[model samples]
Target: MWPYVAGFIGGLLAAGMAAAGESYWRRRRRTKWIPQELQRFFRVKDSSRLQVLQKSFPRHMAPDAKRGLDQWLAEQGLAARLVGVPITESFINTTGLSALMAPQGESWYQVSSVEYESFDVGGDAPMECPKHALWLLDGGDAKLALFWTYGTHRVGCNWVERLRIEAGFVMDSPGSGLADQVLARLEEAVHSGHAYRGQVLSLGGEDDYRGNASGVTVHRLRPVARQEIILPEPTLALLERNVVRFAEQRPRLRKFGMSTRKGLLFYGPPGTGKTHSIHYLINVLQGHTTLLITAEQIGSITEYMTLARLLEPCLVVIEDVDLIARRRDESGVGEQCLLNRLLNEMDGLRPDSAITFVLTTNRPDALEAALAARPGRIDQAIEFPLPDAAGREQLIKLYASGASIAPEVVASAVRQTEAVSASFIKELMRRAVQFHLECRPDAESAIILQNDVDQAIEEMLWSGGPLNRALLGAGEGREQP
Candidate 1:
């Protein structure tokens, strides 16, 4: 009976040991799985012989970079496929994206991402992009592995915590130099492939204002017609010749060894058509990408210029430039630094680059003398002065919503708006129409009477007070300030 019991215990112990050994062996096989697959795919004896090269980009641009890489690869007639490497959006190995594909030296595998990080990148729908992914790619004689990770981030944080887009290429170690070549092309693609190209965009989001690092927001501006801008004939022609005409003559200018890049200053009081004229230029330069940088965003001018180069035939609108253009000596450290950067970028542009810098400011007297004296920085400074009686008449007629205003009535309103802005007249016409419609809603093309125009002007100039007058673009409103 004792011998029988001992035999049974020994058998049980052997079985348990055998099971444990098998489990360990399976775990080891699973660990080697990805490396073995990569080795076989590259037709190399060892995984160490494979080289992994990578590039990092701003996190906000990760999705764009991925799109660029894919677009560039597709253009090269190559596609990447998975080789059983796992993926997850939240998981990131400190070494690199290689951990998801073929870890460089020491690593583990994490997998399965059914979700994508997506958002509107100048499109109606959000752009869907992989948060983490690995792929095996073959381009004729070149065999490579591609790894991408959205990288890690902490909310409201800077780039310190790996806030970037990591893209890597793994290939044979002898160095076919293929990775470097592909990376160069990929970098260009990332820049040119930006979805914001040929679209109206502005930098926003981050308080730090680190160029593209801050983030991009798209804006939709309805097309403004050539007839819509209300500047005087001389001012209008000068603007068209400097901006639209210059663009058309880019090739000829470059051929003649002249610079295609230009900087124009639009100086005037508020609502005198500086911004309105820019919108017209945008419509005229149909193929150009427009970037609007407010005074607060001036810090990112350098990055904006880099983008302008990539998306050439670009219109860069800088509003209230006088804020930075104040005499540098009188300026604080931060202000002086920004003004220097702005000047440097404007001067740094290539002669043949097709970028037009249009800067707007209300106080030309407050502008830095250096900025005005700088030759290339202000190729032309067009004034956006308050309209005279003739220009005012045109503005009133234009904004009247096709209402038949008696010639006498228009003449009266134009005289009253002598020193007011094109924008003020635009609002005056709107209020006049509202008054007409309120009393005559059923009438088509209601006649705008003198009373209607006068009442609207009273409401804008008197009822709304000084703040409202300024808000409506009224310049002093017949009062000396």
Candidate 2:
């Protein structure tokens, strides 16, 4: 009797739900109110029709996309396996002709037995990427699909990396957008590297990884506080205003229809704190992504700009800009080509882009002045001259790290180090401390007197000769006229 009563109640509940579902459908009410699981019971059409969809991604993004697909498929309970096939090469030889690869339409290669490569994903261990992978999902009455992840490498062509999805799904239902769903997930994978939004990245040459196209190195730089950088008050303020403060006001700048994209030129002798100033700027703009490029990496400017545009609110630092961005009259033909590209990249950025370029160089005269004089190319020019007397004293104290030094000796040393770089002060203090240590190794503290500093200067300037002095930035400490 109890069983009969339960059955009768279940029948009534099902009937009532079916009637309500029909009414909701006819009225077109917001269907989201209905729980997906509850609706699944009523709609039970098994997958039947077969279809395929495919799309290509940038070569650099292929490895990342595969990892993303792996995680997603695992969550969906799909079974996958890699199918490694031997790459084949067919070469035609003639009596007078040398053996050559068949064609893009037909060519083969194998550095190793397999083409699986390991990519560094900014983790303790690298992720393994296979040449080809096939995934199968047999969800009986729900999902019947196969996914393929692979890349295509043509000898001279740029086309690479493709994701293909083939599925047999419930045909033409009100929902069941399988193709769109997979693509949406793939899009997530392709643009998910560099760890986080605000990271320091550099484009490495194609020397390390065998097959990976974009050798992106994640830089974990220590953040520097303002106190650490010893710059003139005005110069420091200019830096803060141009980069840090501007980055902070990106939202307001965009709202007012002003171009947040800007460029900065830093020209001075080497070791004058240009690089150190950039480090401080990095600290202030911790929320922005920074990309560092050496002059040798100018060939990858197109890739770097793409990244800058993708990662907005970005900082691009090109060290020794004069190497490529030289005055047209002084630069060679090759240098001129690169200079044009660099200028074009700067000028082409949208006014709304929050990208800042900080270019450093030792030779200001070498610069055609194209970057600094141009309106859109460079927003501001900041000179990193040799430190003044006051800065020299601070640097000495800073590197000395609370050593026992008298005020008179400090003043005298500062005078002797005139027209030298901040680096010179740093090196001088190091040598002075060494001399003091040699004389008083077991002393309670480092007591660097006038004689100790004088001896160190003599070794650097006079004993070492002109070349050594020039390299060390130990300018001749002649008394003023």
Tens-digit lDDT string for candidate 2 (279-358): 88877786688899988878778879987876777999999998897787778999988888788888888888889999
lDDT of 1 by residue, 1-481 (tens): 9999999999999999999999987987665455556556677656455566777665555556767767767776765665333443443435454443354432455333334555446656656655555666677667666666544554332332232333333444422455666677667766664666788877666443222233666677888998888888999999989998889999998999998899899999998989988998998897899999988888777667877787788999999998888876667888888888898888788888899999899988888887887787889999999999989998888998678898999999987777788888999998998898888879977789998998898898888788998887886636632
Residue 390 error, candidate 2, Å: 1.0
The alpha-carbon deviation from the true structure for residue 440 of candidate 1, after best TM-score superposition, in angstroms, is 4.1
Q: Work out the TM-score per prediction.
A: 0.78, 0.73
Leading candidate by TM-score: 1
What's the C-alpha lDDT at position 190 in model 2? 70
